[model samples]
Target: MKITVSNWFKSGSPWVWLNAGAVAVSVVMVLGLLALIAVRGLGHFWPTAIVAADYTIPGNSQVQVMGQIADVEEIPAQRLVDAGLPKPGNKALIDRQLIKVGNRDVSGSDFVWVVKPWLQNVSHPKDAIALERREWGNFYGFLKDVRQNGSVVASGTEAWAALQDSIERAEDIYSQIYKIEKKEIGHINSGLERLRLKERSLELKGTNTPEALADIAASRAVLDAEYKVLEKELGDLYAAFTRDSIQAQTIDNNIVDINVSKIVRAYQPNAMGFFGKVGFYGDKIWEFVSDDPREANTEGGIFPAIFGTVMMVIIMSIIVTPFGVIAAVYLREYAKQGFVTRVIRVAVNNLAGVPSIVYGVFGLGFFVYFLGSHMDQLFFPEALPSPTFGTPGLLWASITLALLTLPVVIVATEEGLSRIPSTVREGSLALGATKAETLWRVVLPMASPAMMTGLILAVARAAGEVAPLMLVGVVKLAPSLPLDGNYPFLHLDQKFMHLGFHIYDVGFQSPNVEAARPLVYATALLLVIVIAVLNLSAVAIRNHLREKYKALEI
Candidate 1:
């Protein structure tokens, strides 16, 4: 056979052209996605402008809409008194209310001010929602303070302490009720004991003579009379206690009473910043990251979402890495290439192809409902009918993702194992190294990059998954952080917020969908960035390993 080698390339091979076309299409798709994210996400930080305004009440009872005030300066205290403005709260003479008396109707409706320049003489009084003429920096400064100081800038803690004191007060009230109820319960229980004693005594009545029987009857009459009195007292006490507890609880849980304690313990600076309102927004991410879920608008920002996303990814990584590596090692290093092995491999691959939504259902049905219900039955019989694992939870979500990504890890690892020379294994055996030692010390180090590659892919997939999480563990909002200061800190069964789902919720589920559209784009951009960062870091680690092992040509 004459072996002739040609340097010429194939000009018309459809396979070559087809591969190039595929690569081009992939590149375009990736680049387009990146561009879209950048344009929308990065745009959220741009500054917006605001205008000044003045309002005047009509002489007649009508809605008055008025405009521009001519250079209305904040009246200093002395100026305020000279102008005869009301001096309320703690302020210098200039601490009087701000007002603007403009001539025309071209007033500012767009720009906002917290300490708005109120016209000293109000011609119109309908507009109470006065935006101050304070600089936007005031808003940013307020947010910064909240971020640094954490809710209590001044009397926030006092308010919380007062609330706590109220809670203790409620406890005292309950204790008093319990004490009252205890006396009645004791009487009822005593009567029951007497009745039981009488029953027992009757059993021995047959053994006694006529004189003994007469004496027993007399004693029984006294006990029976006592039982009637006890029963009557218990009935009265139960009725009274039931009514009292219900009444007290109604008072304890009163909207006004609860809000009063909340009001006392709440963080309400006389001059509130934008962060103060973040809690008021009632958003889930804000609740974890800020103090007042309702009153806090910006203070309860997305920091908690960032924290949670990172934490969840870390948890998933921990769960998947070891099991994945072990499975791969078994398949490639030990398993025989027979019918069973082929079947297992096929099953693993098929598992990867399973819809993530299906995995979520599996997690909910098996992990949460079946397993959790069983656990509750075994451990917490007292709390029956309440779920243990029957509720959606973070642990189930993590485990589900781990199972979902297991195939990737296994396949990559097996490929890496196959690439290692059989001679290396033989050589290690000849040198008296055990198979276990060789596999652990030699095979593992070489296959690390492949293992990491699998993990990276798995993480990317898991990070963006929303449908599965929606069914299994994701909640619209949770009052407490999944990880918190509570005992046994990481509450895995607790539900959590996610950026991917947040985008969907804000964009679709929000009452003000139009207002939330921009936020949706921004959230999507952030999620993509997070996933990219994780993937890039994993790739960097894989590269480092590749460089480290270049000398050991597998």
Candidate 2:
């Protein structure tokens, strides 16, 4: 048996099995982590039953509490006493629950911790409502009545049904208001800014003559007229949206008026059926993917962050690919294999090991403060002080990342070029092909797979980088997307959002820590999926190229 084991080790079978076991363990660990995230993150969208309970204190009157159960934990009873809460008994361990008693406008807090033993009565009221509002996070209450123009139109059993209908109508009007504000008015504003810049340019060149001034005036007049019309329409829409309101009674029995337009969705999770829940879950997932964030990014969707991350990655790929490939080709095909070449190659390898934040600092100084400021001074003087490209933005961010990942591509491409047999190049040369033609037509094609492999690795690393992006371009919230319907649809100078930064900000910087926790996991899962999708695409192309060049290699 000892001889057999020794022979297996000598034959490398044991090493192969050890490596296979390590790989299997890694995959399982990764899947397990993803599963945990999915359960916690995706479950956030599901409507949880709101509980109404009477929380009793040792000396004070009983207080009614209502909200979803957000989290639970066990702690030593001594800890509660140390924290100034009255200890119930001499028990070593006690259960504590964090309740999401959202009504931040009234209570000033969305979450509160309560000792489970201090509860007098705990119940899930069927009539209880959980209102997802555009502001104030959420409101947990009972629907008292629905009103239109300050008169009660719905009460008792009819209030719930009426509230739903009013919300639908309000949402429709809200959509119209959004379209007018972001699209129609946004376009007019862009045009007016352009006209202002044009006037400034003409003035600087001493071309502000009567004819030019008159034409500018005419264009401004047209835009001003359009803006006035849109402004009036927006006012009318807002008035219509605010016409309906609902009166809701909090758990403490205070009646508050809530505008229907402010509510995103309202449903009694305790009363919802399976199909109802499925429908609600689907809607929430869609909203998370499509809508804008609200409540300091603790609530609502992350669409802007998603769009920004994908857009930045694409721009980085476009900028990096050609430059990396070209540099690789020059080094491998043209440059002599000597000491200087070896030194350059060594420096390129060293660059890959540099901290990513160093690249951010470099980009900020050279690209934004230097190159961008010069360009603004030369061609965009009218928009000076405002900075435009002379700030951290999409273009600078892309360029910085391209520089960071350049070394990886260079190394990969060179290895591929080296792997191509010298016989292939010599044969092409013998067939009356020039050296340039031989290198381009024969050598580069085989190296295409390696180029893609480098890109895949670059994307995987760049997509998840938050520290570098925060300095270069990523913002907590971007009002407008980098790509829009403006004259130059793709705005390289615009500041943009990113998923990695969103996760960091929402997870760490949010005032409501408990509320933002699940969102952190969800955003993280989404970022991983995005990187995986991009890497898989490049990998597929690489595999195809390898297959295409297989016969030549053989």
Best TM-score goes to which candidate? 2
Candidate 1 local accuracy as lDDT?
A: 0.57
Candidate 1 lDDT over residue span 1-554, tens digit each: 44333322344456687899999999999889878776654443322221223332223232222222212234455543454543433555232222221111123222222223332333321211121111110111011111111222223323333433443444454445444444444444444444444444555445456665676667667766766775676566444333211001110122111111111112222233455544433333333344322221111245555656777787988999999999989888888879999999999999989998899888888988898888867765444465646688788888888888889888888888888888878888899999999998777888888998999989899998888888778766665567754434687877887777776777777653333555566667778888999999999999999889777754
lDDT by residue (1-554, candidate 2, tens digit) is 46787797799988899999999999999999999999889999988899999998677788999999988899999987897778887799999999999999999999999899998779999999999999998999999999999999999999999999999999999899989999999999999999999998898889999999999999999999999999999999998999999999999999899999999999999999899999999999999988899999988899999999999999999999889999998998899989999999999999999999999999999999999999999989888678878999999999999999999988888888889999999999999999989888999998899899889989998998888888888899999998999889999998999999999999999998999999999999999999999999999999999999999998
The per-prediction CA RMSD against the true structure, in angstroms, equals 17.0, 1.4
Clashes of each: 44, 0
The global C-alpha lDDT for each of the candidates, from Candidate 1 onward, is 0.57, 0.92
- TM-score of candidate 1 on Cα atoms, chains taken together: 0.56
Model 1: ten consecutive residues of lowest lDDT = 136-145
In candidate 2, which residue pairs get closer than 3 Å at backbone N, Cα or C atoms, i.e. clash?
A: none
Candidate 1: where are CA atoms >4 Å away?
1-29, 51-300, 380-385
